[model samples]
Target: MARDRSRRSARGNRLGLVIVGVVLLAAGLAALAVGRGLLGGDLAATPLLGDRTNAVLAQQWVPYVAVAVAFVAGFLALRWLMVQGMNDTVGRLYLARDEAGNVEMPESAARGALEQEVADYPGVRRARARLTESGDHPHLRLALTLEDDADVAGIWRRVRSEAITNLRGALELDQVPAVIRMSMTAPARNPRRSLA
Candidate 1:
């Protein structure tokens, strides 16, 4: 699902930033300490990290190694971006296996069934459902329009018991994450008779 991918990508980015930030912070603080004479020695005489000749830094393959690392990092970043910008279609619900072959329920069919079931209840004027499959979980969103005097509590209880419970069972899932919204329709109005 797009939401799942977005969240995962965001978490990865945050973690990477935190690591990079800490490393930079530490390096900067160390440099400041050295510059301010906090290292208990003359700054000019302080031995540098590498040897005088710096043979490792002058290696012939160092440029090639740097190029390889940059290429890998760029490739990974592009992959993450592509995943984030993906289409959310073609998601499905998990169903049981049969003797013939594996059974899978299309998400559109599941959404339609849910909407129909909810709309069939008394006082429900209109209803719609959408299904999105997240990692290891399926999401269900419902929009319901009800009569002005509809029993919100009773209808919601039934919806939870009948629609949500059955959906979870049919999909063989532990839980089906849902977002339900309800609105009341305006009362019907009648035309007034003309005065004589």
Candidate 2:
């Protein structure tokens, strides 16, 4: 959703920049043409400035200023358009937590769903899920908190498989992949405590 919003905003900005550029370019061209006539053409001979000779000289600067401003404005507009194009190539991603408390099914609803699934793992105390896009596939990176003595590899494999299954089911997507990472491990408790 965020990605879609960003793309829309960028597109709007590009359109605005284009409109401003066109207006400025047209105004600049008109100003330059008028300035040229005022400075060097028969209009220059008019004593509007009280001095026909000085009138042309005084107006010569107008065309130069108009042309320079137009060029600068056009360049800026082009640059903005380029930036907007680049933005379209790079969309948005996010880290979210699942809310439904279901880990067996694909939590492909959004970032939140995946996060919730991570938290539901047996050894996990907390979990964070990040959604990313690579090529055409959606990749999920999950960071989980676990007990220190937990079987890290076993838990990681289980989480990865479950997440992939759930996401694939929820999103109806085949390219979903998951990576499980441990963020922290709790200290081991004494097994003999129950006997005491």
How does each model score on TM-score? Answer: 0.50, 0.39
Question: Each candidate's lDDT (Cα)?
Answer: 0.81, 0.65
Model 2 stretches astray by more than 4 angstroms: 1-109, 134-136, 186-196
Q: What is the lDDT of residue 32 in candidate 1?
A: 84
Runs in model 1 deviating more than 4 A are 1-90, 96-101, 189-196
Candidate 1's error at 95, in angstroms? 2.0
Give the 10-residue window scoring lowest on summed lDDT in candidate 1: 87-96
- Candidate 2, residues 1-196: lDDT per residue as tens digits? 5457777987898798799899999988866766679546776444455576567768869789979999999998799778656522213332232685423322244667767876777777887776665323466666788866666787778776786687666655666656567856646575556654
**Residue 187 lDDT in candidate 1:** 74
Q: Roughly what TM-score does model 1 have, to 2 decimal places?
A: 0.50
**On residues 106-153, what C-alpha lDDT tens digit does candidate 1 reach at each position?**
788877888899999998999988776552367877889999999988
RMSD of 2: 15.0
Cα shift from native, residue 10, model 1 (Å): 14
Best by TM-score: 1
The model with the greatest lDDT is 1
Model 2 is weakest, by summed lDDT over 10 consecutive residues, at: 87-96
